[model samples]
Target: QRGECCSIDHSAKLAIPIMVAKSDGAINQLCQPGKKRRRAITRGQDEESQKASSSRRVTHSSVRSDGGEESFKWILSKRQFTDDATKQVIDGRHCIWSRRRQRIGEFDEFWTKSGKSWEDLTTVKDPETVISNFIAQQISVHATNANSNACRTAVGMLFRIQGFHEERINGFALKQIMKKTSCNYKEEEKGRTNLQVRNPSEAHTGKS
Candidate 1:
């Protein structure tokens, strides 16, 4: 038995505790035999190797601020929001129209506060309904119907100028909603006008 070991030697190896240094700089004593200790060491080495490989792979693409790899979804979201052509168009509008710039700012603030991504328009279920509800919600916040209509128009223009297709913003549904809103505004105005005209006549008759 050239390299053979007796039962006593094997028992001695099993009785000893092996100290293993964790990746976090902590020492963990493993009460394992030779075979178990070897397997544990191999597993730890494999994990380190995988992590190093991941780091190397990330160097070929954009890195996040936190030193992590940029995910495809994150990259796509950034591109959609910061596209060069879209930025130029928006900048031009801002320079030419102060009111437009303000309205666009409001829309941007609303969108950012909602915590939604542009991708959600296409990816979410019943996007048309979702978009309609969002538009309605925005319009409801204004004190006057005219201001509400202006808010709706601003949101639509912003979506269009950002290169969103008709389908993306549910154009047909939006048109119908706008038509309804306009009719409602006219009816309210007419009622107020009639009341103003009638009030003076009644006052004159009472005086007579």
Candidate 2:
């Protein structure tokens, strides 16, 4: 009777270790290859569970969730300066000069032809004041069309004088013109096309 009880107690201890081993095996299959080798071994393990866990592990490593790299590339490719803004940078000085010259010419014609001496006009200390006053009066007649076109032309001339690439200048101008005229549709279509052209891989991934 004592021998029978001893045999049963030994079997009970071995059964506990077997259950522990099974639990370790279940956890091991979820771990990577290097990690799996470190886990405890087990008997009576479920083959299906091991296969499922292995598949999941492979999927996790193979699939990328973050689109950050593609997004950054897209943004960089889409970055561009508008024509008006570029024109402002390039031709601002010339535009100012032209406006001042036109004002001086008008002043000379008006005062000199009316019997005032050229010396008297030249003696005026503040040319800016005279130009400002004259511009205020002309603002009503030709402010919109004249100012905009003159500024654009000045910008174009500046770009040419500075030896900027014509293609780049035209592209910048085109973007500005489209933005100004289309407002919604052109911008949206441009954004879509830019994304398509820049990120063909991303589009393919989405389609699949």
Best by lDDT: 1
Which ranges in model 2 have alpha carbons more than 4 Å from their true place?
1-104, 113-115, 145-208
lDDT of 2 at 192: 68
Error of 1 at 98 (Å): 2.5
In model 2, where is the ten-residue run with the lowest total lDDT?
64-73
After superposing candidate 1, which stretches have Cα over 4 Å from the reference? Answer: 1-88, 91-96, 117-131, 167-170, 201-208
Q: In terms of TM-score, how similar is model 1 to the real structure?
A: 0.43
Q: TM-score winner among the candidates?
A: 1
Model 2 reaches what TM-score against the true structure? 0.20
TM-score of each: 0.43, 0.20
C-alpha RMSD by candidate, in order: 22.5, 24.6
- In model 2, residue pairs whose N, Cα or C atoms come closer than 3 Å (at least 3 residues apart or on different chains), thus clashing, are none
